[model samples]
Target chain A: MTYCIGLRLNHGLVFMSDTRTSAGVDNFATSKKMFTWSVPGERMITLMTAGNLATTQAVISLLEERSKTLEERDPSILREGTMFQVARLVGATLREVIDETTNEGQLKQDQFSASIIVGGQIKGGKPTVFLVYPQGNFIEITQDTPFFQIGETKYGKPILVRAYDPDMSFADAIKLLLVSFDSTVKSNLSVGLPFDFQVYEADSFAMGTTRRIDENDKIYQAISEGWGDALKDAFQHLPSYKL
Target chain B: MTYCIGLRLNHGLVFMSDTRTSAGVDNFATSKKMFTWSVPGERMITLMTAGNLATTQAVISLLEERSKTLEERDPSILREGTMFQVARLVGATLREVIDETTNEGQLKQDQFSASIIVGGQIKGGKPTVFLVYPQGNFIEITQDTPFFQIGETKYGKPILVRAYDPDMSFADAIKLLLVSFDSTVKSNLSVGLPFDFQVYEADSFAMGTTRRIDENDKIYQAISEGWGDALKDAFQHLPSYKL
Candidate 1:
């Protein structure tokens, strides 16, 4: 299980993901889910994955290798002209990796199935976010749906739906993502601390901000505690039913 | 789809459920999802149902018939000596309905499957809550797991986990439930307005308080507005990330 969110704002894009992976309740490990590829001022692409670690790692390795070679895969993340093209490239690579794993009997199709959130700034296109399904299909963020949440999504979705603003500052967007992640980590065992986050300002074609939030980060601690206290206070003041 | 919750607390029990039922996004109707039965001073049982409306209605009709007859079904809900017995009776009736529907070529087992939450007070026993599965198995709420949520529960769970207290007052419990329902209602189209809520005091063995919260109820409106405002204020005050 994992929780990753990508937000498409008017000014920039925000991406966040948890790092915990579990084969079962007893076997737990930490692995970064957020990956970034950039050609300096030309294009910067960020991808966050959720589901089987093996499938995601294999897909990432394949993409990295092809981008370096530029032989069979002509349109790599590095060379894609638009964000949509980058999404298509990632989706194709993921589909190929899943097909290979299924044919090898390494895992069932559903067992190794994974979803990815692709968000980036292409040299000529605006910053955008896309949610890539396990079946190699994807959809872009729209005005009605400005953010995409991939795994363990429901527990943290209400806040995002309620508080999201298209013109929110990068700092505010990061704060929103942290609050959303905090809600998920508290309720779900599979999603935990050490969340990776990134921000990309539109037209910059480079990563604007990046941070890894751990369990004991002072600001994260303050936000978590503050939100809990505020909720209790809000509850105390709610109008009670007249009996 | 539906959303219902049953909470067991040190002082009493709380049950709340929405009233909307839909087949796909087109066919929608309002129906009661909460039911109550009591022997006045001996016992009082409250039930909330979610899932196939036909199955829940049939199960409820069967229980009502048996309680009135009291001959063939000796341990009817009306005559159950313990809260557990009442839960068992409801579970068995629900299972029988599901099985009968399955045998009649009406629908598949999973298609008509339902879940129920039972909470009550018996003359000689403490107030308790039970979550009844479609297979006729049930689990009682304990100190570690003091609540049960059925159908469309995930969106509303984080707040309950963060704010629930075993010793909170009856009014506080009702407020908490309303908040949970509010969150679910905002995020989901299946659960809607006109929620039924009940409160039972410990060892009283009779219905304590009951209310149907509608779209225009004054207290319900106040709570909803207050909670939304409070959440926005909290969001505004959260410290922004420094990059």
Candidate 2:
């Protein structure tokens, strides 16, 4: 299980992902799920994956392996003219990986599958975010669902649903995301810390800010403590039933 | 879709449920998911259901029908010897109803399903809560996972994960639950307003507090607004990365 969020806001884009993966409760491991293909000032494409670690890693490897080829590498995440095309390339690669793996009778019942959050901008396009489904298709983050979450998404959805807005400040977006993640971690042991987060300023054409929030991070500590206190206070203030 | 929660606290128990049910985006209707069996001062039991309205209604009908025969029945919510027995009765009844309605020919992948939260106490028993699965088996809420949620649970889980404690006051438990419900209603269209809630005081052997919260309810509005603002405030306070 994993929890990854990509938010598109007036200020910019924020992507956060946890780094824990497990086939089951007893067989847990830590693996980084966020991969960046950045040409620095030219284009920056970030991909966060959830589901089937082997499958996701295989998809990433296949894409990287293809980009090294001469003919098949034209629409790479680094070479694509638009973020949409880059998403397509990633989707296509994911489909190809699943087909190859499954055709060999190595996987069963959608076990060799993955979902990716692909977000970035090329040299001439606006910043965009997309939730790439397991079947090699994708949906963009619209105004109504200004955010897209993948992997263990339900546990953190309420906060995003209530707090996310297209016009939110970047700072507020990050905090809401942290709280959302905190909620998920508490409820589910499958997702855990050292999260990778990247914030991009609108039209910056570069990664605006990237930080790794670890278990001992100060900001997270504050958010955790502050959120708990705030909730207790909020609960106390609600009107009780007249009994 | 629905959102129902049951909490077992040292002081008492809390149960809350939303009133919305939907077959799809277009076929939505409101039905109360909560039912109570109280013999004034002898025993008080609250049951909340989620999943497959037809199945849930069937289970409730069976329970109610059985309650009618309590004078001659061996095990009923009203006639059970202990809270544990009451839970077992509910689970066994759910199983029987499910089996009666479903057979091999009628089985689909998602057929014959409902989960219930049963909470309260008999005269000599302490407060207790159980999460009854669709299989007609159940698990009691413990200090570790002191709360049980059924249906549309993910959207409301963040708040509960952060705020729930075995030792929380009854008033605090109710407030926390409302906040959790508020979060769910904000996110999922399937779970909506006009909620039924009950809070039982330990040892009272009767319903302590019960109310219906609607769209325009003042406290509901307060928690909604207060939580939204608090989340934004907390988000804004987080330190941004220096890039």
Candidate 3:
């Protein structure tokens, strides 16, 4: 299992994803789930994936190969004219991988399925985000729903629902994502550290700050421990039930 | 779907369950998920159900009927010698109902399955909580893990993990539960208004205060609204991330 989130904020787009993958409970490994493709000052495309590791890796590899070899028949995610077309390319790649894997075996189709979050800005389009489903369909983020999450999402959702502000700063957005990720990591073993994150500034058409946060990252530790204490204090401030 | 929690605290046992049940997203109705049986000054037991409504209703009906008719060969839940025994009887009854329902049709066995949280005390034993599985097996809550949640459990769990204290007052316990239930209600359509809760005082061998909290209840409204504000404030207090 994995936990990943994509936020569409007034400032731009914020993306974060956990790095843990497992074949079973006992076999775990750290694998980066966030990918970026950028043509400086022209376009920036970022994607975070969750679900079957093989399928996600395949999708990313296909996108990477297509971008490098411009002569290929398949469209490259980086060459797409708009964020919407990039999402379609990613979705089609995900579906193609799942179909190929499922057809080669007697196993269930869902066993090799994956979902993705694709968000960024192209030269002419507004910065945006989309949630690509395993069925190859997708939905873009709107003002009514400014965020998208995939895999192991429910544990961290309450805070996101309560605290998200579209006008929040990139620093605050990262803080929010860390708190959300901390909640998920503490509650479930399947989603662990180090986390990969990328920030994009709207209309800049270039990736902004990007980093990997591990267990020892000083700020991550401070927020993780501080959030727990803050939550307890917050609970104390609520009016107590009577009778 | 449903959301029910059985919490073991030093003062006694606390149980809360949402009332919404649905056959499909478009069809929903209110149904009580919490039940209690007590012989004053001798024993008290509270049970909460989650899963297939038919199976849970049948299990509760069987327990209610067996208790009323002493001539039945099956042991009455009210007559169980200890809380553990009561849990076993409830689990067996649940398994019995699910087995009966599945065998009568060609449907999958899991379609008739249900889970339960049973807690309380009989004269000779300590007050405890048990999470009863669909297979007629149950596990009791212990000091290390003093709570049990059934159905739609993830969204409301982080706060419980962070704020629960065994020595907290009953007033605080109810407040904590309201916070938990409110989170579920806001996030899920399958769990909603009019929550039923029962509290028991250890060694009293009788049910304590029990109430149904609806959408319009004053304190419920206060806590539900106040919690969102409190959480947002808490997020502000956390140290902001730097990029």
Best by TM-score: 3
Clashing pairs in 2: none
Whichever of 1 and 3 has more lDDT, that candidate is 3
lDDT of 1 by residue, A63-138 (tens): 7884455566543678778989989988888888788767565553488889999989887788888998876879
Candidate 1 lDDT for residue A55: 93
Best first by TM-score, ranked: 3, 1, 2
Please provide, for model 2 over A95-165, each residue's C-alpha lDDT reduced to its tens digit, 9 standing for 90 to 100: 77778777665553488778999998787788889988777889987777788898898878876776677
Please give, for residues B118-234, the per-residue lDDT of candidate 2 as tens digits: 988888778889999877778998778888899888877777777777787766677788888888787778999899888888878777778898999887787788777766555
**Worst ten in a row by lDDT for model 3 chain A:** A66-75
Query: What C-alpha lDDT do the candidate models reach, one value each?
Result: 0.88, 0.81, 0.89
Per-residue lDDT value at A167 in model 2: 82
Share of native interface contacts recovered by each model: 0.74, 0.53, 0.79
Residues A114-197, model 3: lDDT tens digits: 899999999988999999998788999999999999999999998999999999999999999999999999889999999999
Q: Give lDDT tens digits, candidate 3, residues B78-197.
A: 677878888888888888888887775554337788999999999989999999999899999999998999999999999999999999988999999999999888888888889988
Ranking by DockQ: 3, 1, 2
* Number of the candidate with higher lDDT, 2 or 3: 3
Runs off by more than 4 Å, candidate 3: A66-75, A104-109, B66-75, B103-109
The residue-level lDDT of candidate 2 at A64 comes to 76
* Tens-digit lDDT track of model 1 for B1-243: 899999988988989999999999899999999999887888888899999999998888888885455566633788877888888898889888889768565553488899999988888888889999998899999999999999999889989998999999889899999999998888889889999988988878788888888999888899888888888788888887877
> Weakest 10 consecutive residues, lDDT, candidate 1 chain A?
A66-75
